[model samples]
Target: MAETSLTELLERNARHVESLDSDHFAGVEDTQAPVAVSICCSDSRVPHDGMWDVTHPGWLFTPSTIGNQVWDIHDGERVVDGSLLYPMINTRTNVTLVVGHTGCGAVSAALDAVQNGPGMVPAGIEKWVDLIVPVVEAGLNDERIDADRDVSLVDQLVEYNVDRQIEFLLESDDVPETETVYGFVYDFQGVYSDERGRAYLVNADGETDVAALRELAPTKYHDAVDRLLQ
Candidate 1:
């Protein structure tokens, strides 16, 4: 198959726009209504809309970053407080979804930086990946995690990063009290068993236990908790 050109991509988007009716976004304009804010990884395989099964526009405000990591490093960092959190706070969105995925390139890069050094990658990338040092350290220090095995450490970091981001949001005063945040790891490989299409419920309302997760999570996620947490 031939690679698609810029012209083709533009024409395709134009065709999609032309096909939309005038009422496409009828009730969504000029309002700061409650919407779902999703912070996910910048991986094309994990399409936010498709994952949520949302076909309509304006239902979800998605801000994707590398490894789906959120930080409170300082005021107005473009990735954290500027673009993603600003909109979430301004819109007063009631739910914040912090999603991480398996096989994340950013997570891999972070691991490499931790094992090797910051000089292994570009300067900008080194700093960004360094933000995840705590997560990597936690994984390395944990007795249960086998750091020698690539998959074990990578998977642990992926889930840990999601939990870490959720914790950051919960600690922030900018986040509304009415907001309910959830953390999830989108494991295309299920249960650490190489199965696919599982959304593991790692954290809910600041709780990571199976009991707390069971109370708040949908029935679909119960099995994931059991399998993945096992």
Candidate 2:
């Protein structure tokens, strides 16, 4: 038989669940445990479990959506509030991660929509992209930044989107005041970028001193957590 596509593979696996070992279902009902919540893009390539393993280890609670935009209102009416915000506030997971990526189709489409016109984007998509337009505007307004640089302005916009989303998360009532939140950009190569280069962690709070983070003894990641804890 020919190789199966991922969807088909998943379907096939689901069919074989009855014959699988008992351990597959063991401890499956443990719902009280706390987890680190990660809000990432809906892109299939960006696997949250694998990314967190390389960056921050152990169990995590992850929520995903296209564009990674978390807004309280939807379609001019508050239908869903913010997706991950409520969970962060109510659940044991206090830490939240807003992960963005390079070459994001949504970000690129939004930039194009702003430059040209909404064109083919439907009303819902247009509304969603509108949440990220300010980041694109910020990237465009930065004189020292070149839109055509090696990483491209769109990539920078994606990074900025992550930062802005973090701000949105912070401003929401659903996010606990004491909780720690982080933002990062996952590049096309799966590398997270920061001012410190391919960093796995980037402090979304603009107040963090980049120079001090770079000079930390153990690692920038550790120092970032320390700063937040302080």
RMSD of each: 3.0, 5.6
- State the C-alpha lDDT per candidate: 0.73, 0.63
**What is the Cα root-mean-square deviation between model 2 and the actual structure?**
5.6
Tens digit per residue, CA lDDT, model 2, 142-188: 66356666656676677667766777667666567777777666655
For candidate 2, which ten residues in a row score worst on lDDT?
221-230
lDDT (Cα, tens digit) per residue for candidate 1, span 55-124: 7788888888777876636654423555567667787778888888888788888788778776566776
lDDT of 1 at 64: 83
TM-score for candidate 2, residues paired by index:
0.74
